[model samples]
Target: MLLHPPSGTDRVQGLAARLGCTVAEHCEPYGKFKPAVLGSLSGLALTLKEFGGRWDRVERVYVFANWPMLEAALEYCVRNRDEARVSA
Candidate 1:
């Protein structure tokens, strides 16, 4: 998933076409954040490289493998954040 600011549909669609996949925009007034493009890792990488504004517009990009792994990662992130706060 690639999350970017709003109003990048043309760029997103063009990149998605070049990547041989379609894009699902999650812009404001309907969904959270600006937009998020979900597709293959390769396609996402290409889109990020070609049209992702050099990591400017992009707010977050998540790549999950499975439910277990995703859950584990989320747990780890939460624990890490908590530990950091405690240490601070």
Candidate 2:
């Protein structure tokens, strides 16, 4: 699963070109589908932070990871006063 850029912006494609796995689905609402990789959360966060072009245009990241990781990420963001990437 991957985060999409804001509406009207282009959908980020070819991530599989770099990551070696094609996106199984898009528009996967949180809690509805399982994530194939556990590390994608951190990978995406770091990627968006370090490379800020269209990534920064991302408006939300709907988590498909387990509830614990999701809560932890949200808690960390709240504690650090950072914007949450996770969408409801």
Candidate 3:
């Protein structure tokens, strides 16, 4: 559900791997949620830690599973992004 800026897919995937995630680069029907990485690696160190080290930005590492997870992530991502723009 994360709307990456142009070409953040590969970086996201690598992050997923570093965190012990299994990435699926495409989702049918819900193609809008393409390129998902199921499961999570909370115990492992986040690979995006260098990307400013913010929980929000690192969390956008893009991982999802099931319909509800996908839906929630999409909503949250959009809302957070909008909030960022408004504040900026």
Candidate 4:
């Protein structure tokens, strides 16, 4: 599960812990640049990339985010629909 909770909120943290989900905390700025792109869904991509071979075996993706993040998640799923079951 990839959960991008709103900024300054910890309500989701406890739930994430209970659900055994990993929460990504990005403290970087965002824009069109590479470094900036690392804060949104791209960050999630980086996380998955870190998994190396394991990424290929991933069959499901659950995204919980808002606005642009959710938009990006949907786009990613559309592009890789055959690879996994992506839910937002």
Alpha-carbon lDDT, every model: 0.40, 0.33, 0.42, 0.34
Off by over 4 Å in 2: 1-32, 35-44, 47-62, 82-88
Task: Tell me the RMSD of model 3 versus the true structure.
Answer: 12.4
Clashing pairs in 3: 25-35
Which of 2 and 3 is ahead in TM-score? Answer: 3
Q: Measured by C-alpha RMSD in angstroms, how accurate is candidate 2? A: 13.6
Q: Give lDDT: candidate 3, residue 22.
A: 48
- lDDT of candidate 4 over 35-76, digit per residue (tens): 011112333565433322123113233333233443343344
Query: Residue 84 lDDT in model 1?
Result: 76
Give the Å error, residue 35, model 3. 8.4
TM-score of each: 0.32, 0.27, 0.31, 0.26
For 1-88, candidate 2 gives per-residue lDDT tens digits of: 4433233211122332233222222234343542222223444565333322122123233332333343343334343433333431
Cα deviation of 73 in candidate 4 (Å)?
A: 15
The candidate with the higher lDDT, 1 or 2, is: 1
* Model 1 clashing-pair count: 0
Winner by TM-score:
1
Candidate 4 TM-score to native: 0.26
> Which candidate ranks first by lDDT, i.e. highest?
3
